[model samples]
Target: MPEGITAECLMENIMEKISDNLPKQKNASFFEDDKSNSMSTQFNRLFGRQKPVHHLLGGGKSADVLLWRDKKISASCLTGATVVWVLFEWLNYNFLTLLSLAIAIGMVAQFAWKTASGMLNRSPSEVPHLVLPEHVFINIGKLVGVEVNRGLNFLQDVACGGNVKQLLGVVLSLWAVAIIGSWCNLLTVVYIGFVAAHTLPVLYERYENEVDGFVSNALDQFQHNYRKLDARVLSRIPTGKFRGKKFE
Candidate 1:
C-alpha cells in the first residue's frame, strides 16, 4: 500500500503475514507456497493454530474473501492457458514436415522461456528455482503432466459444462488442420502465422495481468488472515489491561 512500493514487495509482505504464525520446519521458499497448496491446507487451521487475526474481526466487518479466491483463479487461469498452448503445439507436431515442425517447436520453446524469464524479471526479489529433470524427455513429460492435470481442472471449472476429452480432441484436430493447411498453400501458412503472431501479444498481456492480479489477491488474503490472528491474541487478555488497543 505504500506509495512507491512495488507489486512484488506488496506480495511478499502479504505472504509473510499469512505464513508468519504457521510452522516453518520445511524451510520452503515463499514462492513455492502457492495458493493451490495453501488452500488445500485448509483455512480452518488458522483457528487451531491460535491464529490471532480470527478473534479480532469476528464481530466487525465480514472479511472480503473474494481477493484470495480471485487470486487463485487468475493464477490458475494463466498457468493453465500457457500449458494448453504449449500442449496444442506439441500434439499436432508432424515429423514429415520437419522444417515447419522444428520451427514450431522452437517458437513454443522460445515463448515458454520468455514467459519464465518475464515472470522472474518482474519480481527479481522472488527467486524461482526451476528444477530441471535429469532427462529432457522426463522434463517434457512433467510439463505435459502439469498441463494434463492442471489444464483439465481449469477447463472443467472455468469452461464449465464442456466435455474435457472432446474439447482436447477438438484442439488437437485444429492443430492438425493448421499444419495441414499450411502445407497446402504458402498463403495459408502466412495467414496462420499472421493470426497467431498478432494474437500472441494479447495472450501475453492477459497472462501478465493474471499474474499481477494473483499477487494482489495474495496480499489481500495475508492482510485478512493477519487481522484474524490479531483479534485472537487480544481476546485472551483482561479487558482492563488493554482497552481498545490496536495491534500493530
Candidate 2:
C-alpha cells in the first residue's frame, strides 16, 4: 500500500518476521522437564495413594531384599528337586497327601512351641507372615490393567495402518508361544521361568560383554537369513502401496 513498498518487498518482510519467531533449536531442558513430569504423574496414578506396608512381605524392596537374594537360588533348587522327585514317583505320588503332611507338621510345631512358652511363662514367638499387603495387589492390578490397555492400543494402531509387518510378527510370536504352552503344564512353565529369571540375569550381568557380543552376532546372522529368505520368497509377492510403506 505504501509508495516504495512493492508486493515482493511486503512478502519478504512477512517471511522475515515469521522466521524470526520460529525456534532456532529445540530446548533439551524443556523436553526433559516435560518427560519427567509425565513419568512422575503416571507413577503417582499407579501407586501414590496406596498405603505403605512391611517391606518384607511383598512391599517396596521386597523383590530386591528377599526374592533376589540367596532365597531365589534356594527356591530354584527346590523347584528342580521337586520336579526330579515327581519324575521318580511317576505313578505313586499323591500331591494332596504331601500337602496334608506339610500342614500337619507345621501345626504340630506351632502348638508345641506355644505349649512350651506357656509352661515357661515366656512370650510366644509371633507367627511368620506370608500374606502380601493390599497395596501390593492393587499395584499389580494397575500394572496388569496398563499392560492390557497398551495391548488394546497396539491392536488399534495395527488396524489403523500403523506397521502391519511388525504387528504381524508380534502376533506370530505370541501364537507360537501359545502353541508351545499347550504342551506344558502351567506350574512347570512357571517354575522354569522363575528359575530362569533368577539365573539368566546374574549370568548376563557377570558376562555382560560376552553376552552382548553373542547376542549381536546371533542377531546379525538372523537378519542376514531373514533378508535372504525375504528376497527369495517375499519379494515375489506384490504388496499394495499402503502395505509396502516403511514404518518408523
Candidate 3:
C-alpha cells in the first residue's frame, strides 16, 4: 500500500523489527537467580525423589521448536553438506588432495602473472620468497600445540570451577567430536570447522540480537529440563571433591 514498498521490503522491515525487539543481554545475577529458582522448582516437583524411567524417553519439544524457527538455515546447511559429500564421493578426492591441488594451481597462476607483468614492464621478475617444507611443518606443529593447550585450559577451567552446565557442555562437545571424527577424517572435520567458524560468526554478528535471543531461550529451556533431571538423579550421586581452585 506504501510507495516504494514491495512485499519483500515490507517483510524485511517486519523481520528487522522483530529482531530488534528480541532480548540481547541479561545480567549475571538474573541468570543465577533463574538457575536457583529452576532447581528449586524441579526439586519440589519431583518430591526430591527419582523420576520414573519413562521420563528418559520424553522428546525435546523446546529443541524441536528452536529447530523449526531456524529451519531455513538448518535446511541450507544440511543441503550444502549433502552436496559436498556427493561431490567428494563422485570425484574420489580427499580433503588433503583437494587442498594441495588448489594450492599448486594458485601458486602456478601467481607465478605466471608475475612473469607476464615483468615481461610487459621490461623489469626484474618479482618472485616471492618461499619457506621450506620443514619450516612449514614446524610452524604448523607449533600452531597445533597452541590450539591444543588452549582447549585443554578451557576444559581445566570448566572442571575446576565445578560448573555443572559448562562441564556437561564440554562432555557433550567431546561426544559430538567423537561422533564426527568417526564419520570423517580429521582433515575434513578441520576444514569444515574452519569454514563454519569464519562464516557463522559473521552471520551471527549481523543478526546478533535475534540469534542471542534464540540461543538464550534454548539454553533456558535446556537448563530447565536439565535441572529437573539433576534433581531426580544427578544430585543424588556423590562426585569426589575437586582440589583445584575455581577460575572466574
Against the true structure, what is each candidate's TM-score?
0.18, 0.51, 0.42
Number of the top-ranking candidate, with lDDT as the measure: 3
lDDT of each: 0.54, 0.66, 0.67
Candidate 3 lDDT over residue span 1-248, tens digit each: 66557887988999998776664333556788899987765554322434432232232532332233356665566567656765576577777987898899988998888788888996656666876779889999999999998888887988886666568878999999899989987656855774564356446446655665566667779889989998998888666556796444
For candidate 2, report its TM-score.
Answer: 0.51
Model 2 Cα lDDT, one tens digit per residue, 179-227? 8789876655765676665566455446655665566667779889989
Ranking by lDDT: 3, 2, 1
- How many residue pairs clash in each candidate at the backbone level? 11, 0, 0
Off by over 4 Å in 1: 1-134, 159-195, 198-248
Lowest summed lDDT across 10 adjacent residues in model 2 is found at: 45-54
Q: Better model by lDDT, 1 or 3?
A: 3
Per-residue accuracy of model 1 over 181-205 as CA lDDT, tens digit each: 8666544354456445434434433
| Residue 49 shift from truth in candidate 2, angstroms | 34
RMSD (CA, Å), each prediction: 28.0, 12.5, 20.3
Superior candidate under TM-score, 2 versus 3: 2
TM-score sort, best first: 2, 3, 1
Off by over 4 Å in 2: 1-108, 116-132, 159-164, 235-248
Clashing pairs in 2: none
